[model samples]
Target: MTRIVVLGGTGYAGRHIVAEAVSRGHEVVAVSRSVPTDQVIGAEYVQGSALDVAPLAETLTAADAVVSALSPRGDMTDRALEALTNVAELLSGTSTRLGVVGGAGGSLIAPGGPRLFDQGFPEEYKHEAQVGIDSLAMLETTDSGLDWFFVHPAEVFGPWAEGERTGHYRDGGDVLVRDDEGKSYISGADFAVAVVDEIEQGNHHRERFTVGY
Candidate 1:
């Protein structure tokens, strides 16, 4: 089984990713500030901030990959980037890969042009979206040399809809994924599938990929 660590594993998207990783029979270590309430059947929970480097390194040392699901609050984007850089530094010489959950703001709305957030995004979410965009920028310029992939979710993402695991979704490049009805969304479960699928298949290295229905 692939040994994996998921930073911020208690949040909405993180929880689903953790569950999906465990369901696929991978060994998982989930780290978050607060402990998770819902018990993931096969994951070891670690309580701590993603900013804690020493503990984060200790958790990542034996892992095959690290999934960063960290969502920065307020102006904590810098702090989040520092933590991610620390993790990348720690895994620099190893074979461990890093897969970050990127934001939709970074995804392209047109070919070689502006992003979604640049087109008058809602003020309420603009800050958070900027953080994700900044994180992706950091990943691109950093000299860590570790294998990394940024997975960007569509405009709408939420808890998994109650149903069988379909493992079906559309994947796209920098552009957003939209359907005929002019809707762009992906179920959390399906998003998790995309993330894990990338982890297993080893595609889209050092780049961002978008997902939707």
Candidate 2:
């Protein structure tokens, strides 16, 4: 079983990915600033923040893969690029792969259209969205050659939707995913499925992909 480390594993998206990884019989290590009241049965939880880099690097060395499931919030909205750059540097030359839980705002609405962040998105969410966009930009241009993937969710994604685990989702490039109903959504549980599938299958290397119904 692959030993996987998830930074921000107690958060909304991270918990689901942890659950999915454990269900697949992989060794899961979850690191977060605070402990979760409820823990996954087979996962190991570590209480720590990424802001403390030395200890975080120790966890990276022991993992076969690492998923940065962090969102841009509070001070993190400004510091995400630094945090992610550290991750890229830490994983450089190691076999451990990196996967980022990305925001849809950086994704294009069409093949050659403007990104969601540039299309007059809600004002309140702009800062956090810009962080994700910047993180993606940084990863794409970084000189370090690390195996990584930035997986973005659909426009409607969160715990509120909580859709069922169909174990199925359509994958797309930089563009967002949509259906005939013009509703693009994916439950956290199923998003985890896609994440684990990517971790195991190793498809779409060094690029961004999205998952939705």
Candidate 3:
């Protein structure tokens, strides 16, 4: 089975990914600052901070892939990039692949021109969105040997609208995935499926992809 480590695994997106990976029989480790009151069965939860990567050396060493489900809010408002960079440096030459969960704001509105962030994005979310964009930039300029992939979720994805798992999703490369009605949405469970699918399939190396209905 694949060994996977998920930072911020107790959060909304991370918890879904952990549950999905564990259900698939993958060895999953959920790392966060605090343990979850309701933990996913078949998954190991660890109390850890992304800011300090040294303590996670042993765990990082054995991981097949490390997914950064980290968010840039609260105490991590401006430090998420630092945490991701540290992990990237630690996994630079190793065989472990680095997977990042980015925001929809960095997604392209069309095929070539404007990004969602470049348009009239909410001022409240601009900071966090900028962090996601910066994280992608850091990955692109990293050492050539590092295996990495970034994933951008649809415009409406969060705990507020936790939809059921339909086991289906469409990928929009560099562009936001929207349905015929011009709506971009993906259930958290299906988004997790996309992430784990990429882990098992190894598609889109060193690039970013989007997921939606």
Candidate 4:
């Protein structure tokens, strides 16, 4: 089984990812600034900050994949990109795959046209969205030997709309995934499923993909 390291493990997206990975019998290490009251049974939670990667060197060395579920918010608003960049640098030229959970804003509205961020996006979320875009750009320029993948979840993905796990989702390459009604959404658990699937399948190397119903 894969040994997975989740940087923002205590967060919403990170927790789901840790749970999904553990449920699949993969070795998972959840790293965060604080510990959670509830924990995933089979996963190991480490109290640490992603901003400082030097201390996490040993913990990250043997990982088969390192997933960055970090969101640019609160104290991390300005440093999220730095943390991810450091992680990318650490995994460069290594066998460890870097998987990033990006925002919907970076996704294209069409095949090769406007992006969701170019349209009227909420002002409050602009910073976080830009971080996602920048993170993908950073990955694109990394060492060719560094295998990686960026995932943009549905427009409505978050704790607010935490739906049940259906064990199914669609892969929208570069474009946003929406239903017939033009609604872009996916449950947290299902998104985690897509992530683990990618980790195991290694389908899209060094590229970005969107996930939704």
Candidate 5:
């Protein structure tokens, strides 16, 4: 079983990913600002801020891979991105692989053209989405020796709908995927499935990929 560490495990998408990882028989260590009293079965939860490097390093030691699902609310996007970058730095020089959760804003709407957020992104989400987009760019330029993969979800994510474990999704190369209704969306459960699938199969290495139903 792979020893995996999940940053921001208490959040919406992170929690789903943690559940999926544990269900697959992988040993998971979840790190967040606060530990859930009712933690997921077969997983270890650690309470710590992602901004702190020492504790994060200690938590991630000997981990097979690290999944970063950390996000900031509103204007805290820059701070959140900085903290995540610090975590990436700590994982450098280790055997751990990094899988980062990216924002739809960074994914291409067209080849070599505008991003999702660029094309009429909601003002309310602009700051946080930009943070995610910037974080993906930072990961791309990181000189650290860590092997990393960035996964971008569709326009709709989180616990908006109760979606079943289809165990199926279509992967796209940096571009967004839309259905017959000319819309793009993914359930948090399906997104978690995609994340764990990548971890187990090791597809889309050292690059970014987008997912949709």
Candidate 6:
């Protein structure tokens, strides 16, 4: 079984990813500051912060891959990028692959066009959005010696969507994934499916990809 470590494993998207990965019989270690309300069976939960990676060195070093399901919230605001940098450095010489969750704001609004952030995303979400964008920027510009993959979800995604598991998804490059009707949406459950699939397949290496219905 693949030994997977999920950072921020109790957050909105992180929790779903942990559940999905565990369901697939992967050995999962969920790292979060607090435990989840409903923990998945057969998964290990560790209480810690990604901000401090020194103590987590062993956990990260031994993992087959690390998923940055981290979302900037509360004190985490404006700190995701920093945390990501530390993680990349910790896994620099290791064989662990890094999978970072991306936001729709960083994705292109169209093919070879401006990004969603450039078009003026809602002010309320700008800070959190920029954190995701900055994390991707670091991945693209720096040579941290870490094999990284950034996965962007649809514009409308999260636990609130409460969508069904169609067990089907479409993957694309930096461009946002939309249906024929031009609707951009995906359920959190489906996003987890895409994430775990990529981890197992090792596709889209060192690239940013988006997934949606």
What's each prediction's TM-score? 0.92, 0.95, 0.99, 0.98, 0.94, 0.96
lDDT of 1 by residue, 80-156 (tens): 77777777777777888999997888888878868899888889888778878878887888665678899999888
Worst 10-residue lDDT window for candidate 1 reads: 157-166
Which should have the higher lDDT, number 5 or number 6? 6
Best by lDDT: 3
lDDT of 3 by residue, 1-213 (tens): 999999999988999999999999999999999997899989999888879999997898689999999999889988999999999999999999999999999999999958999999999889989999999999999987899999999999999989999999999999999999999999999999999999999998999999999
In angstroms, give how far residue 48 of model 1 lies from its true place: 2.0
Per-residue lDDT for 108-184 in model 2, tens only?
Answer: 88998688788879998788778888888888985556888999899889878888888999997888999889888
lDDT of 4 by residue, 1-48 (tens): 899999999889999999999999999999999888899999999988
Residue 82 local lDDT, model 1: 73
Candidate 6 error regions (>4 Å) = none
TM-score of 5: 0.94
Clashes of each: 0, 0, 0, 0, 0, 0
**Rank list by TM-score:** 3, 4, 6, 2, 5, 1
Q: Compared with the true structure, what per-residue lDDT tens digits does model 5 show for residues 93-151?
A: 77789999888888888878688988989998888788888888888887758788999
Relative to the true structure, candidate 3 reaches a TM of 0.99
Output candidate 4 Cα RMSD: 0.7
lDDT of 6: 0.89
Instruction: For candidate 6, write residues 1-213 as lDDT tens digits.
Output: 999999999887888889899999999999998887688888899988879999999999999999998888888877878888889888876789999998999999889978888887899989888889889888887575778899999989976787988888999788999999998898988999999999999988789999998
